[model samples]
Target: MSHASEVPASTPTIVVTGAGSGIGRAATRLLLAQGWNVVLAGRTEASLLETAQEHSRALVVTADVSDPEAVQQVFLAAQSHFGSVDVLFNNAGIFGPSVAIDELTPQQWDEVCRINLTGAINAARAAFAHFKVHGGGRIINNGSISAQTPRVNSVAYTVTKHGIAGLTKCLELDGRPYRIRATQLDIGNTASDLLNDFGATQGALQPNGERMVEPTFPLQQAAEAIAYIAGVPLSASVNQLTITAGGMPHIGRG
Candidate 1:
């Protein structure tokens, strides 16, 4: 009669990108609290450290996901510190300043595409390779409600999110034979800094050129949903999950 605590240190190791704030931070905490070792990857050491405070199993790696070499080092650091990487919460992303498609500069579009779409691809590739070496692993990508529906004045951001959905589906198919499982969480209107700022500022912009504050729920709800996906047996992974505010327009609104 041995409990999970008996071999807790042998629990799965997870890598979390964008671990500095918001959803990444919340997911890292939830994973660590569940006795999983987490590698914190972010450009900011201070914020990553803050998320990993006083946790011995947490390893902090400063990384910008858009850089190929930097992305490699993050996984290398994970292997170096934790012996192996069993899961990757590929959550690094940014909502570039909203602007109409006609006004969005080429550079602006490139930057968002590089970080949001290319970045997720890089992390997933690294995770897939690592999983092949280690026998198996899980990848949970942080997609957005934008994947299903474009947002007002969010041309660049919405396009990148749609790319993430396509990537997630491809990974699910490509990784199956190698014991690598991929899942996408299409999140919306969680009470994070980004959503809160939206609530305070532009609120919700309707397709008909109106604005209203969309409802929001606790960040923990999304984090916990991720944990649930990660906790399931590898043979039974959740391919896609959408968690959003109860009253969000994602359900129906012009």
Candidate 2:
């Protein structure tokens, strides 16, 4: 068979959290371009609408993933718009305060956990339930390389990302009977507002003062990688994937 014919043409209905910006935005655009209907979810309604307006198959829904009720509403809206959710890209997360653990405030700690770890759980809960009823789906989480080797002064973000690894594994096993697949993509510095903000807050400069954070990634590269993982056949699956910048310190424990 030709390579073109080898790829599946199943137009999946995809739900992407944190779709207002960054990797989520890239994923949404890529999926839409590939002829999939994407439901974009994020806290910013205006940005979400802007993303939706650009794509004929986009359905924008604004909701905070940390709030269970809001997450439910978002999913319901997605289902209503797309008939069924074939995949959920659980990308909504916060980097939290880039303070040393000792200096990190209780509020900052809680908020990060709420958005980073709990948000994934809540969205997965909703998505898994829907998949169970609707006959199966895929859940792809946006994990960080820091999940395994953390950066200094980013305890909360690191901890939550580590939790995501466990979550991905657990869900993968549990969803087997339903044919639902769960995977984690351990990302290393891709150019985005998150990295920009992280640099602003944490000083992305080394002691010698080299600038961190490239202006932008070939966003299409990472998005296409994820699109491939999400579009895999039910009989086979990509349980975990990692995509990172070539010069990123993510490969090492740095």
Candidate 3:
């Protein structure tokens, strides 16, 4: 319970990372529709532009979240365009190579850690710094149910998402004094480009000589959930939220 009521609204300024695709893109569209001045940051300019084109209210910027310099520029541009950012959708992440840890390459591990974990750290750091000075802001990290339940071939992804849960908790504690609210969404399978990219999802060979991909939830459902979280006032914050596909086997997952 920090001094969140101190600032008057002139339309909330928000920054969303990984805005080029998936949940990020969907969330961006919702925010723009609500008239929030949103800055879209991601590695791909083409995708960013395409996302922005769908909504005239979006400010598109190409940024590699893995780089600190690039993140700084993103912040500067957001502040320059919108004055102050009231919330950060820290959603950039990479679901690393699906393989056993023993078979996973060091390079692959590094890439996942860099994007999913370290990249989150960088974004949170920059956003917190700005928020602290501006009195307070909200942070929402895109976590995965994998953090709680491990997937056999997704070691790196699980590890990074676990780190994200820790990140969210620590930030929630540290940010309380500054009126900065932090939360994480531990999402289960949702319809997105990431799922479509899994080559064997339709049916891939497994140890049992069978391939199985879990059913996916509609992307719109996840998008709506995210928007609801974002729309919550500073007085009340959702510390953590987990929304998954109704029929998904996450409850029984190892």
Candidate 4:
């Protein structure tokens, strides 16, 4: 971690969890390019370093968002390196075992809740505390489309995402007086490694028990949307923003 003295005080800083790949990595790269100090926090140190790519404004911190202590450490490291953290991209999550409700084990459910829901809450708690003291900040959560709708054999993932939606609302209500803003970015299919199972040729499982290929947009577009929200001022808050492929069957998803 670089010392706070090394970075200019005026530079805006954002902490991005799960910054190793996919949307998190894309957003981090774009933020760094746009002259923001970024703190890359993820489970894999090597992957976080790769995301940082030796950027002078990037600080790599390895952390599993499920662990509250580790998540707190991420904020501390960010503040120590950049003087203050202005935003937190709460984007760490995982799709648990794809099994029906009856077939899903308790351990599997607990594991998913621990990371997807608990992890997000932990990060938000830390960010809220920091923001309250520093005047204000923004939190952009990667809620995913599952936050509003469910897919077959995705009970664990779906439930946690719904929890994220609730968390976002609570943060918004609670942070109003402190200038802390919260936004939930629900994204649909995007072109990334995580979508390999639901690729154009592979096809994803549909609500009616059939499989169909779903349309997807570029990863860069999703990244740009996040950047736009993060750039919004505290006086104005984007409570919720949903982005999906034009041809994606989300609006009328069964």
- On lDDT, the leading prediction is 4
Off by over 4 Å in 2: 1-10, 200-216
Decide which is better by lDDT, 1 or 3: 1
Q: Enumerate residue pairs that collide in model 1.
A: none
- CA-only RMSD, every prediction: 4.4, 6.1, 5.1, 1.7
* lDDT (Cα, tens digit) per residue for candidate 2, span 140-215: 9999887878766688899999999999999999999998999999887776667754683245643344545433
Structural similarity to truth (TM-score) of each candidate = 0.93, 0.89, 0.91, 0.96
Best by TM-score: 4
Off by over 4 Å in 1: 1-9, 196-202
Q: What TM-score would candidate 2 get against the native?
A: 0.89
Clashing pairs in 3: none
Q: After superposition, how far is residue 170 of candidate 3 from its true place, in Å?
A: 0.7
- lDDT per prediction? 0.83, 0.81, 0.82, 0.89
The local distance difference test score of model 1 is 0.83
- lDDT for 146 in candidate 4 is 83
Question: For residues 1-254, could you state the per-residue lDDT of candidate 1 as single tens digits?
Answer: 00011224366888899988999999999988988888888889889888988587788888889888898998887776667888889999988867798999999888888889889999998999889888888899999998888778888888899899888888888888888888989998887887743442356677788888778888888889988888777887679999888868885455
lDDT at 177, model 2: 95
Please give the lDDT score at residue 8 for candidate 3.
29
Model 3, global lDDT:
0.82
